[model samples]
Target: MANYLLIAASSDIGGATARRLRDGGHHVITTARDASVIDPDVVLDATDFDAVDRVVAEAGDLDGIAVFAGSMLLKPAHLISRAQYDETIAASLTTSFAVVRAAGKHLRNGGSVVLSSSAVALAGLSNHDAIAAAKAGVIGLALSAAASYASHGLRVNAVAPGLVQTRLTEGLTSSDMSRKVSEAMHPLGRLGEPEDIARAVEFLLDPANDWITGQVLGVDGGLGALRPRQRV
Candidate 1:
């Protein structure tokens, strides 16, 4: 059985991914900022590089690591406050970097690293300024880290998900009108579930998919690449 680390295990997608890994008979170590939530193996601030390094070091030979630390902010760039932008960047981009850095230093050869990005990072979406920027940084960081660590046999990839039905996104999906509008944006005609993205993360983390690296897997229900057809 392989060993894996999941940062921010309290998040919906993170919890789903952890369950998937454990069900496959792999050893999973989980972390979250809040100890009461999810009762993770570690209470961690994933954006803190020193804390991330310590976790990786203690894990003792990890096969894979995935960072699910992120946030959602739907506000225009012009209206976004300085603190909001900083928080967004720290949550997603900074946390991703911390994981990648730790993985590079500690993960075993041929190990995998998965990061969470967003469809808005690749496709244009209104009122997603702060989050889009942060997730976009994650993509760039993943690609570069993949390149840098390729020589050491480490694989790095990012999963970009579209609108997902989770506690974090309840504000956007709780209303019928908002839900329909969001669903209509995806060519698949539905919002993504946490399991959907979890499956993608599982795929990337599996040793069977070792050939894949430096790739951004879009788990966005066709939202990142396709334009939905007009309804008559």
Candidate 2:
């Protein structure tokens, strides 16, 4: 059983990943901003570098760490306010950097670090400027960190998921028209579930798959790489 830390466990994807890891007999230490919700081992604002360091310090001899802290902002670049853009970056890219920094200092050699990116980062989608930029940064960070940590046998990778059905996407999925549009965008003809992304994360975290590093696994139901077939 490997010891792992999951930041922002209150989020749907985070919770699912934590559960999946635990079910596989791994010891998962979870953290979230709200302690009342998921009862995580730590109540953390993942964007805070110092707080992230503290959590990493406490999780001794971890085999892996996954940062599931992120935000979704569907707005055109021209329409997005400075505050919204900053918040989006802080929630995703900044939080991811915090995890990377903490893991670099405290994680055991040969450990894994998995970060959350988005399909929008790989595929150009309308009204996704803020989130796309932030997630793209996550990809860059993961690749560079992977290179830096390779000598130590550490692996750094990311999962770029399509629109998964979660609270963060309730506004889009709850509406029939919006949901249909989103479903059609993915060649798979449906939206992704939290489990989809969780499985990818679990795959990247598995020590058996240690050969993989610096790659962005797209758990996006083909959204990032495929176009839907035209109906006759």
lDDT (CA) per prediction: 0.93, 0.92
lDDT of 2 by residue, 157-206 (tens): 99999999999899999989999999989888889999999999999999
**What RMSD, rounded to one decimal, does every model reach?**
0.8, 1.0
Model 1 lDDT per residue over 31-96, tens place: 999987799999999889999999999999888998899998899999999999999999999999
Off-target runs (Cα >4 Å) in candidate 2 are none
Mark the regions of model 1 whose C-alpha exceeds 4 Å error after superposition.
none
Clashes of 1: 0
Q: Residue 99 error for model 2, in Å? A: 0.6
TM, every model: 0.98, 0.97
Clash pairs, candidate 1, are: none
**Residue 161: error of model 1 in Å?**
0.4
